[model samples]
Target: MPEKVIIRSIISPHQRESFTQFIPLSPDMTREIGRTVKEIFDSLGGAALLKSSRDVYVKPNGIDAKAYCYTRPEVVRAVIEYWQSAGARQVYLMENSTQANYTRVVFEVNGYRDICRDTGAIPLYLDEEKTIGFEFTGRKSIYDGDPRGYDRSHCEMPVTVTEKLIRRRDENLYVNVPKLKTHSMAGVTLGIKNQWGFPVHTSRGHDHNYNLPYKLTDVLSLLRPDVTLIEGIEGTVYGHYPVTALADRCVKPFRVLIGSLNVAAADLAGAKILGLDRADVAHLDQAIKRNLTGGVTGLDDIELEGDFSTLENIDILGDKPSSGKYPADLFDFFPWDVKVLKGKELACREGCVNNPLTLLQVLFHDHNGRGGWTLVMGKGFDPDEIDEIQGRVLVAGHCAIEEVAERLVKRLGKKKVYLSGECNDLAATAEAMFHLMKVNPVSFLPRRRGAAVLAFLMARLHGSKSRVPNPLSHLIKMV
Candidate 1:
């Protein structure tokens, strides 16, 4: 008989009809979360896992500092409190934020510093710590024989993790806390996708293209979480980083928490909660294929603890999961006059295609849509085929730069051509787009003018070298 992975899902008594109703952390909500976590530990032989002498490290999904994008601080605090009550030696909350952003800034902006101070839990910024190299022997490329695929020559991938996590991995507990949300690239961001924070920001772009799923799975194979807890209290729809203005339509109040010992099993349940099947998520499919599901061969192998059927299916990317294509009407609602001309040959949904599109979505929604530019991505665009080109030309990604940047620049003059080179470099993309639209990049920040200026200064003084485009450097040009 195949090993059964036990998944515990708890639905809170707090239910609201409106999706926009913001649920703040209350005493009742805390009690429910605490009970749910205790129940999960009890089911998993609490005596063996929750030891008094063990060190605990909790990894929360701090992808972005924005609300509803990262893991809720309330959830992290509950996990820390539980471990502390069990007499754990130490409980550390750690994360490396997404590219172009600093983890320290995220901690400050997301109220993690207060959580750490109140709970006596230390905040470990992985970006500032030293990284150790681990061997990766898995298949390097998703494509069989493509020269442009992930480099097979380099067998070691350096991840930013402390020596404690590397040396005392078996002596302690590692928990993964990720928010349940749909991704424009990976279909869904859950426990499995949360490990993307392990790699340094500079090296992330190496395998950020079509091979992202395999890369994410490879990272999981190296450092699998001991406990996977997905915070589903409030889930984001359409995509993970929807602006606050769009929260009414984008955020859903699920009031549910899902946990499991196996990351794959936890993600499978989380994906199902988001109305995604195993086939819809490439990483989940790859994890099962590689036997990383902790004997969860498929969705049928899971033994659910709660009434999963009561949870309605929240649409993943407008009810079109696994399509690997952005919604046809993503830009229709906005009155942005920008024209996106993608190449006919190759467009990796995970990288060049979605990166700029997501940024554009943010610009359109929050910044009032900066228009009058022609953005070109991917490859195989013959300059001769295009009869008339709109406004200024912005070439994105290495593929587009290599294919048509020179010709486009020659036709449009040097002043009109803006190049943003790299697969998923949000910093470069933002700079190019801002330049083309003639908008101040600082206007995109959520903080007020004074706070934004102070935050930018603080980020530069004590931020990681791996941070792309440096927040201060980008803001300096605009100011």
Candidate 2:
């Protein structure tokens, strides 16, 4: 059995009134958050648990360039403050952002840099050194890597990890600060998902078939963090929701911090706060099977504090929308699922006029049932060539919003005009035309690879709408 995990909660709303009277934290939520965090650690037997004489490494989530989409800067500040108070030496804040974005950038821009500077801890990048390969002989699992590339095992593979971070002197402690977010591939992302940083040189752009949750836990088991702090102050139901654009979706005042010795247990407790099933996450499932942190089967192992009823205000994870699909749910047709963009006389005034064409290409590839695809452009072709193909038309892009809606309404019945854009509000506007106000990722890519496929599919499914002048040729360079 793994050690019992201690989980704590402090729920509140992100209101100006609730944030009154606090220290360097500025917001009242900070003081409550600090207290709540300290309470959990105290119940777990205190910071003395990390008095071993070794180098302590801290890893915070840094997958995106967005600030609010990540862990709150105050949470890291509070943790560092508490750790310094506990008499820790040589604190290193580390992360390997898949996007190659800087953790310091996120921290500095989000107010964490000052906290670290004032606290006297240095920041380290995880991708800076050579790594040693480690094998997982435990069990056959999901995300099996092909050993043929490096003469390795199906389940076992070489992993590049920093040597300096491997062994702590004696009093070393590793703290994992992770943000809670919903993943499109994995059901949810949390502390375990943060472990993707461990790989010394792997770029985030590399695609893997299985969910990252399992692999993350496997990596963490090797690192064996002394404790984990999951910051839930603000999280997204939709994965990769940029901090600046969508922090308000966080309906509940999750002014709480959850901590635990058992990473799995802590994750379980955190997932509960979000109303997600532990089993729903493949990483947590794999962790349980491999017996990492004593295999927590449920939330029963956790000791909760504060009024968790505040969580009742949280929306169901499935019911949440990411970017697109307000009146329509994007999740309904996620990843190979059918999506019907039923519209009449659709027209593209801006963005990718060739978007419907590109979507048609995608549909063709889909029909071929082949996985890998590439859309390459060669020498210039005549604009008249645009008449060669067909599909239902729709205006999708940032520019399409200016006046395309009214024009599109004149051609396609008002009900058929759905605005798709990178902006949810714009898509929501289209939904409003249909009499439902909801956010959606409606912006369509014109002639781009993904857009090509979507356009192709629409053509195959709905037949080509009337072919116009194909102004997309002129705009091709803009893409």
Candidate 3:
């Protein structure tokens, strides 16, 4: 007999006049979250699981410090407090934020530090720790073979984690906490996709292109969470990153929490709530086919506790009439003067094509549209088209730079050409585009200027070489 999988979701019974005014850290909200977390924990046998081990490691989606992009600190506090009440000896909150952004800075910006100080949960910044390489075997590439002649069957990647998490895996409990959001690359970012942050920043781009789904699944194979809690109080659309300009249209306040011991089941339920089918999210689909879903073969297999019907479908970019096939379509939401040119041969939707475009959306919205610029990505651009390009050209990704950097420099001159060489390297891309568009990085935080400056300074003092927009880097380059 297969193990039974039950996914329990709790919807806040309280009614509010305006969903837009929902405050995540409000006293009322915190109490509600605490109650919901305890109910879910009791329902999912979390206490029984905790009986075997007193140590707990909680991994939250600290992808970025941006609002609505990461798991709310309030939700994490509730989870930590619940675990403590259930006789947990120690709870360690760990995360290595998105590439280019340091975990220390992210923790400060997102209030994880405050949560740790208050809840007595030790904060673990994975990036600051040493890493060891772990090999994942018997994994098959979900996409075509890499152009660089590398086999995806066996992958050995470095991960920044304590020895307790690896050596004493069975002795401690691992909880996965992720925010509900739509991803331009993986369709939906849930429990399975949340583990993407485990890999070191440098190794992130290795299979980030077409084989991202396979890479994500391979990570799951190694670091499968014992319990998954999907925080859906304020879900985001139009990709995982927060879009302040599109907050009205993009952010969805579902006021619900989805939990399960089986990560895949929880993610499947999350996908449904996001108005996506099983096949829509490639990572979830692949995990199901690989039998990593804890015997959950289909939606029928899950015994759901909450009413999914009452939950409205989130409006993601993919749901648009244009299907969001190209990065250019994202610009339609804003009146930004930007041109995204993809390779005629093939544009990797998972990385090169969408990553830069997503960042551009944030920049355009926050800064009120930079001047007209052309972004060249992927490979195989026509010479005539390259010559006709106007203004500064941002040559993004390794393929684009190798293919058209020389031509762009020759036709448009060296001063007109900017290079952000890496597959979905947001830090380098942001810096390159910031220079090309002449946007000040400090200007991004007009209201929280002091906090932002202090965070950056502290991260620097701590010897963090993170690629997040650095004021000093900008000052030196622009000078």
Winning candidate number (lDDT): 3
Cα lDDT of model 1 by residue, 352-415, tens digit: 8888887777767667656877888898876665437845777778888888878877777777
Q: What lDDT tens digits, residue by residue, belong to model 3 across residues 1-479?
A: 23333333444443343433434556777787888888888888967887356889899999876767889888899999999999999999998788767787678767888899898999887766656776544254335553543233443332334356555677889999999888878888889999888776766765567778877877777768889999987777667775676666677676678888888878877777677767788878888787777777656666666444322343422343334221212334543577878999868777788888877877777665575889889998898887789888888888898899988888788777878765777777777767766677665543445665686677667655345755544434421
Each model's backbone clash number: 0, 42, 0
lDDT over C-alpha atoms for residue 27 of model 2? 64
Q: Quick one: best TM-score, which candidate? A: 3
Model 2 scores worst on lDDT over the 10 consecutive residues at 326-335
lDDT value for candidate 1?
Answer: 0.70
Cα miss at 129, model 2 (Å)? 3.5
lDDT of 2 at 158: 19
**TM-score for each prediction?**
0.86, 0.59, 0.87
Q: Tens digits of per-residue lDDT for model 2 on 1-479?
A: 44455445554435553221111334677787777777776776566766656445677776533334557767777777777666666677766544323333334444555666787888654444334566544334324564211121122111223344354324467788888665544556677777765653232212122323444565666766668888877555434332122233422345557677777777776666565666667778777777775656766555554444333334423453342221210122122422222113222211122222223222232222211211111112233332221222233433343434454455544444444442112212222221211111122221133434443344334422111112232222111
Regions of model 2 farther than 4 Å from truth: 1-7, 11-13, 16-26, 135-161, 168-171, 201-207, 211-214, 250-252, 305-479
**Candidate with the larger lDDT of 2 and 3:** 3
lDDT of 3 at 131: 69
